[model samples]
Target: MPPYKEGRERMKRKHSVWMMILVALMAVSLIGCGTTQSNLENKDTAKPAGKITIGFSVSTLNNPFFVTLKDGADKAAKAAGADLVVVDAGDNTAKQISDIEDLIQKKVSVLLINPTDSAAVVSAVESANKANIPVITVDRASNGGKVVSHIASDNVKGGSMAADYILKTLGDKGNIVELQGIAGTSAARDRGQGFHNVVDGKAGVKVVASQPADFDRAKGLKVMENILQGNKNIQAVFAHNDEMALGALSAIQAAGKNNILVVGFDATDDAVKAVKDGKMAATVAQKPDLIGKTALETALKVAKGEKVAASIPVELQLITK
Candidate 1:
């Protein structure tokens, strides 16, 4: 072979080796990118932190008892570093259901309900159950659905206490009138039953007139007015709650019906004052504020997936002048 041909062949071989080295480097770079990308894809993704919010559906704020209850719940929620949303139903069952639905939509951590009517609020409770939100009853209870817990006083016993006091003060024989609460609430039913159990027919002590005042002071006054017209010989009046009791007291005062001892439930501020002023015979003291506070605390525990008791009871007492 010629010397020029041999030198050209050696240069050609050198160029091929350099090209192979470049291709290998390119392949390694591509592999490095793929491995980096795979590592990123497999890594756990971080998510935004979420805040816990609670929703409360109150029966009516017009009444002092429920108002105090709401205040307690509000204070509790604020201390826990959680948001509290409260809705008022104005003692309207339909509105309460709507309020619960809205709360569900808001994705509240817990749903609290002060039902206007026990039976009517079932579907609302069921709706919360469907959403997997825990429900805790305040002041009043629901007739149906799965509730996380119920916190209330023994209404029946409270009712019995009222009746016993009335009868004892009346000397166990007098014409008594019973002022009922909202018709379908557990408080109404239990309280009425308790009164009846004690004074149904004991020593001729009788309930001369029994009517529902819907737990409103204005309605209570009107109902008492109507009852006063027909039952001239009535000696005492028993109202289911302080609102109704206070109403009846107004009517009794307005009618100039003297010596007719008036008693009420729920020792609301007004009722207690009435008793102190020597107008009302008594009012049942249901610590609504404590009930409200306990409810919020239980809800927080539930939010933490902690187990809680099925029922919680608050203290009940009778206040009299």
Candidate 2:
């Protein structure tokens, strides 16, 4: 072969080899970029695992008062961009404990509890604390536990106010039956104490029978019926809640009893209507809507590691004809 032709052929061969190497490098770079983009898209589409979950445990949903509380809480939770899970204990202590356990298993971020029994709920509160979930007590206090906050009305003063209204209406002389709420609830205990304190030294007044109606209107009616079987001369009835007071009214009217004063706690809308209609003498109004709003607000603050007061007090009003 000629020397010029051979040299030209060798140069062409080197050029082809360099071109092949560049193509291989470009192919690898494209694959790497595709893989990285896929990974980033998967990461962006995946749902975040941890969100703020709040467990709201209430004593019962049977009453309208609690229904209002739940409504207020739902509104606040939505406003704060948090999730809320509500559990009703139905005034049963065991059920309340079970509900708390369920919330813990869900790994809720916080607990807002209105205990069935203040003393019985302490262990459940401790369990929440162990899981690092802050517990906020609403409308009541846990017997003994590290609670983040307590939101409740002034029950003691409200109870005393109701008692004084009854006394003045009855001329401080009457045989009254006390219809209490769930036995161990803080509201029930404190309100009962306040009522007794006011009527203790008063003359010509007696609490003939005191019974727990479990804060249910049906139970209150039945219990009042039983009480009326022997004590038809009863002049007044003081119920711990409007439902019980309404129940007492049913029994009173059914048994042809008239001119009996009926005073109640929790000035629910129905209770106010009854007072206007001359069925109930008075009621102590505890703002349940306010309690629910405060509880949720406090829970959000706690989740954010913000400072919250130990106690948030709600006001009480007296409603009567």
Candidate 3:
């Protein structure tokens, strides 16, 4: 009797051990499954599964023109069901170059750049080219690089329009001042060329003084103040951008000067209001918003390996009071 009871006790103990082992194994398996599910959920929620991202490197956000451009790009990107990442270079060429590198590393589908300086941005553009990322330049162009496309207004024509307005207002016989944009930019170079083409050989319309205002309002004001100290008989002023034109107008007003015709480009909202108020004689309107939208559209096409124009020109208009 004692031997049979002992055998029964041994069997019960073995059964208990087997049940405990099975429970432990199941617990581990459940935990592993939960971990996997959590990881998948986290990954799915963090980002869209197949959304394409576009990188936009802006020269400066301080300018209203660039802000408008960014707005247009953002709207277009949203409408196209694409993601956008924007970085402002703050008018620093080196920063812009670094920003482009960062975007390249992110593996963006496309890059939209508004260069701070044309020649200086070539290296950045080339980096994108080497990485096989399509780049579409907006507003300003790189002097050297294989860009898919460039979107901007006909700045040369705009400058000539300003010159014509100045000559018509001043009778083509008055001394003038020119406030230029940032050096090494296509906008400034082309605009300056067009202005000079009209005024360089014109009779009695001398360029008494010309200076680089760096497309900045503060710099324009300071430069105009200095120019006024030397040139007292200036009859008209042409600025490559509206910011500089407004700054020049401020200087003219502060110096108690009046009736000096001032012309500007970009036709920013403030500049348009100034023209309507008679503070500025006229401004060439380059639809910055439209240019930005066109840039994004072209970038999307390029990312899809589609053909796009090498140069896309936006229309320009002259606004006068």
Task: Name the candidate that leads on TM-score.
Answer: 3
Each prediction's TM-score versus the true structure: 0.84, 0.84, 0.91
Write one digit per residue (lDDT tens) for candidate 3, span 1-321. Answer: 699999999999999999999999999999999999999999987767667899999999999999999999999999999998999999999999999999999999999999999999999999999999988889999899898889999889988999998998888799999999999999999999889989998989899998999999999999999999999998999999999999999999999997888999999999999989989999999999999899888888887778999999999999998
Check candidate 3 and list the clashing pairs.
none
Clashes of each: 0, 0, 0
For lDDT, candidate 2 versus 3, the one ahead is 3
lDDT of 1 by residue, 161-276 (tens): 99999888988999999999999999999999999999976877878899999999999999999998998999999999999988899999999986999988889999999999
lDDT of 2 by residue, 127-210 (tens): 998998999999979998789899999888888998999889888898999999887789999899889999987889999999
TM-score of 2: 0.84
Misplaced by over 4 Å in model 2 are 1-51
lDDT (Cα, 0-100) at 51 in candidate 2: 57
